[model samples]
Target: MCVSHSVSPDFCDKVMFLLAQEHRGPLRGGGGAGRTAQEGGGAGRTAQEGGGDGCIALEAGGDGCIALEAGGDGCIALEAGGDGCIALEADGDGCIALEACGDCCIALEAGGDGCIALEAGGDGCIALEAGGDGCIALEADGDGCIALQAGGDGCIALEAGGDGCIALEAGGDGCIALETGGE
Candidate 1:
């Protein structure tokens, strides 16, 4: 999605890269002009995203751009184009995003670390909980990332390298089903 701003008042002559892609500049592009963002003049600059409920709103400063942007009621959403549609975020902080319901929240970290915990509220859903040792984790403490459960082998008998996925944990006793992803 390359957009040129020859008519906009901003870029007089010097090329400037719009780090965040929400409304583009302080304003939205509506003049029938779009340019590839590859024209960003310089590199290694600081950028800030204005709004979004998630930890990552825009990935303009890093790799992978956004796939789609749905400014519904101002609550930035992804387009309904379905799968196979890849609107790359400027950065790749987290994957699979769901709206916060009741009190459920999912946190993600791109390079530093991943979610410290993913919890559901009230009696909503225990999608995450940090006290179990099943193949899949319902919760996680701030420990090994990219390196799954290296904290206390008592943690979850990890096979080293697995995502600490809640898959096996999601199903207990193989089929008895104590509670998917839960003990």
Candidate 2:
């Protein structure tokens, strides 16, 4: 198994393990719960905890699901196992998630200033949320129930593309909100 960034092999193993923990559950794009992934030994907290790197802390809280913990700047938590589900997270300032990938399901969250969540991805239900100043959620994607939510000033929620339930909500002033297709 090839690990990205500086995540320890042991930590990566644990994250892979949790990805399939029946209790951990799957990360269904933007409208689900579960926090998985870490950087530089930061630790992956379930969506329930609602804090930490690669965490799935949605506005609607629930039983924290899964998270891959790590300790490093710009670390990428990539686990390619688990009933066709993959969850990745990045920590520190200005971390970037998947920018261009098609097909398959991906749940990516960035917790830092000027971080980029999901960008130019295709297919499946994609949910990308960014937390911190100047964060960008989803930008130019295609066909899926895309929901993009960003928190902090100068944040951009969604920017074009996708043909499904597109819900975009941004926090703080100067934030943009655009919703089209479905409710």
| Top TM-score hit | 2
- Model 2: residues with Cα > 4 Å off, grouped in runs: 1-69, 80-85, 96-103, 118-123, 138-143, 158-163, 180-183
**Lowest lDDT 10-mer window, candidate 2?**
57-66
Report, for every candidate in turn, its global Cα lDDT versus the true structure: 0.26, 0.47
Supply the TM-score for candidate 1: 0.20
Cα distance off (Å), candidate 2, residue 45: 24
Per-residue alpha-carbon lDDT of candidate 2 for residues 29-77, written as tens digits (9 for 90 to 100):
3333453332222233222223333443222111222233333464444
State each candidate's clash count. Answer: 25, 24
What are the runs in model 1 whose C-alpha is more than 4 Å off? 1-48, 51-59, 67-74, 77-167, 171-183
Q: What TM-score would every model get versus the actual structure?
A: 0.20, 0.45
lDDT of 2: 0.47
Per-residue CA lDDT of candidate 1, range 1-183, in tens? 222111123521211232244445342222222322222313642222323333223223232223233222222322111212212221222223222212212221111123122222221222332223332233332222111222222343222122222322222333322212322
Model 2 root mean square deviation, Cα atoms: 13.3
